[model samples]
Target: MEQHVQKQPDSPVPFFLWRHLNTVRRLVLLLVFCLLILLPYISLYQNFVAGHAYDLLTPHERRIYDVMEWLTAPIARSDPANNLNMIKGNTWSGTLFGLKLSDPLAVVGQVAAQFKLYWPFLLTALLPVGLTLLLGRFYCGWICPATLLYEINDAVRHRLVRLGILAQGRRMDLRLKYGVLAVGVGLSTALGTVVFSAIYPPLIVGREIQYWVTANGVGAGTTFFLLTLLFDLLVARRGFCRYLCPGGALYALLGRYRLVRIQRLVNRCNDCTLCDKVCPFALRPMRDAFGQECNNCTACMAVCPPRALTFRLRIQDQPDQGPGHQGPAHRRAAVRVTAKGEVA
Candidate 1:
């Protein structure tokens, strides 16, 4: 069977800077994630964690009862209210849903304690809220450690499938996210814990490295690198993102309500289907762009030959009129008018 491919467009896009910066930022974040995983054992960043934790919690969570009693200084006289101002006993089972997970390492090793020390709880709390408003789940697309892991895993799976070691499926079977969504919601509502956080890639990698570093040394760091490499180099699609992330599932719901989207002008479309092929999320960009599943990746816009498709920031929903709805006669008449204007 013969296949047709569209030629590249002549002019460049202005948003290439935005796209390039996004790509570079993601790459750097991925590297930081790697370093964070290794730092527990190498003790490069662990001291920072320890110093922060000790400075903040020394009088409360960690100081011995006698030491606390013996200290005559006014600073040593810790008020229960001061120690607990951050956490209210009125624990709503569901207020902070999808915000954070309860990982053993985060909870047990006192690193979680340190995280709160380095950054104010309110500041961290505001990130998802503010980001959700401006960029609409930008954290999920770029910074979330879990998404990065999934992207790497998916890339590996793609190569393996190409090599015939794995079979490819047309349907993404994305219903898995719904299941994870349910479990996360249920656990958070019922148990007052973000159950999904235990398996969340960030916490998983963080905790695993913490344990490994405490037990092994540089060898453990090597193991962590190899595991990350295997996931990225072997998995075809964003396996973890597609199959496991509850946070992603939550943000997808937010995307449904998000106003901004990558829209295609159907009248100008040349039927090249470049957008459909380049979409990483496996969304049919032409048919189902505004259907809440598309991640606004803009791969279609990057490849569009005539710049036919544009990222329209629309205020109202437009009807899904099918492709090239007008007849050839109407198009020819329009083209003649356009040609006459050009000649004049």
Candidate 2:
């Protein structure tokens, strides 16, 4: 029996969508960031002015509140304060979504406070940890507010470079982040406090946003957060996220063997090296198929002229056999090139 193979359409719509998917996802995350910043104010308004929760709002505010409530319904807990602070303790926390978000370093600190005291608390961190194990530091690419700032910083730097005003800074050793992570874990264990979160840019920025939106003022974390921005803006390109962030370090280590990764199609590639230049993390998607440092940010793929790069699931032990050698060793394929040269 003969099987009919469907050919890809020559329309530019699919290509357009694939190229802009990352931008769309980034905008969605930015929207989430805005909502998170506004949530506290919404809660305060509901409690103080409205004098009730969710029921006594103007139609507009009511709609926004309903959306937030629905989004956070899974991890939402009954707090006496009736505030939207999702953190329950040093162990379990919540993000904009209902999923429980936990910093592994913070959990370790709680564990060190007294193993028996925080042993049960460790369970709360499993969700994020499991996600990292499966997805490879997706939080850095998809959710972290720092990535947004880094992208802005990178764009400005690119413009400056085009004008010959800025020189690309030297690349630092990636191991520095891991070293910082080790130091943070050591200090947390020794001091009996979650030291990493206090200085972590993502957490600090989130807290500062909450404070600004709710109280119309900056919080204590603002200074440190600004320093991180300065470090990215003037000192080096993506220096904080790439070299010093202990949280990123934890994610990178936890996600070393993650199944999802960017793969290169050698036949389609023209060796323009644009992907390498566009990557904020300095990943060479053209050369490395399964770079552990890659966060799946899709920046490289966005700039690829031939669309040679794509996300795929491959076995950890699979050999780096370059491209055009798609063997049975690879399990799942997430993208395919059709006869008409369109990616699907």
Candidate 3:
């Protein structure tokens, strides 16, 4: 949406920047998911090449082998097996040009379970941790593969609400996820295993996509992920990410003092409340109350007609900015003060 707040002198929002961030975030989400899907086929092709199994393959398998070979022709012209291995692994942990990168939650989980830090693994998470510290739980919004599915599922929830098949949204304490995170860590420590990979939606999505695509049969997390979809559809809106995700809890904590945060340009706000309505996490962007729970998803900014929302460099959210200047409520209050010399 085009912003009309370009004339506001004190507006913090730069009319030129981040206006389309929501769209860019959506594209990045899809790209990450597409890579997850594509990687499995690449793995299969690498295996096929290693085994020299083209003649032994059935018709369907041969077709997959052929398609993958064609896709990787430029990259793997000389050494299909070695070259195609360059971009391996999923979002949980991956390598590109020998630079390993991983989710900070994964590093935390592994260390907690083993009670020892693998320096190599720990190093892999630095980039993500540093980024989260600066961006505030942006991984949930920008990179998580499961977030892509969760949002699409959220769209379905909206349709169901419109059809009266489901109620609007069920509210709960946002602190619930912190408890889940503590419990998850406790269990991992006690069990001496990284248990979150089984329950966390992002890792589960990556695992299941690799499994199902490679014909390894559906992983057990498939049922659990499906149940989460059901829960989001029937019980609460975006329930898993909103309340139960341990990874989200970890990210939120790490990003609690994040430097970049979305805020309302109160002067430009008309209190349309569209920002509040569109937030997946049920945050009230118009009220200037985005806390640690915000992922900087930019969905609020996209729906705002007056373009009252924008990212700002701040460690904490602004306190309630009250009614928007352009809104009728503020106008009525101004009228009352003008007539009676006191706020009504």
Expressed as tens digits, the lDDT of each residue in 262-327 for candidate 1 is: 666665565667777766666665664545555555556666664556555663335664553232
Decoy 2 TM-score against native: 0.74
C-alpha lDDT (0 to 100) for residue 113 of candidate 1: 28
Winner by TM-score? 3
- Measured over all alpha carbons after superposition, the RMSD of each candidate to the real structure, in angstroms, is 11.7, 9.3, 4.1
- Order the numbered candidates by lDDT, best leading: 3, 2, 1
Point out the worst 10-residue segment of candidate 3 by lDDT: 1-10
Task: Please give the lDDT score for candidate 1.
Answer: 0.49
**Candidates' TM-scores?**
0.57, 0.74, 0.92
Give me the displacement of residue 18 in model 1, in angstroms.
5.2
Choose 1 or 2, whichever is better by lDDT.
2
How accurate locally, in lDDT, is each candidate?
0.49, 0.67, 0.87
Which pairs of residues collide in candidate 3? none
RMSD to the native, candidate 1? 11.7
TM-score-best of 1 and 3: 3
Question: What stretches of model 1 exceed 4 Å from their correct place?
Answer: 1-14, 18-22, 25-35, 38-123, 170-176, 189-192, 214-239, 315-318, 324-344
Per-residue lDDT of model 3, residues 1-344, tens digit only = 22222224266555655778899999999999998988989998898999999999999989999998888899999788899877778888998778899988788889889998789999999999999999988999999999999999999889989999889778887789999988988999999998888998988898898888786778789999999998888878998898999989999999999999998888889889998999999988877988998999998888888778877899999999898887878766666565664433
Q: Arrange candidates by TM-score, highest first: which order?
A: 3, 2, 1
Model 3, clash count? 0
lDDT of 3: 0.87
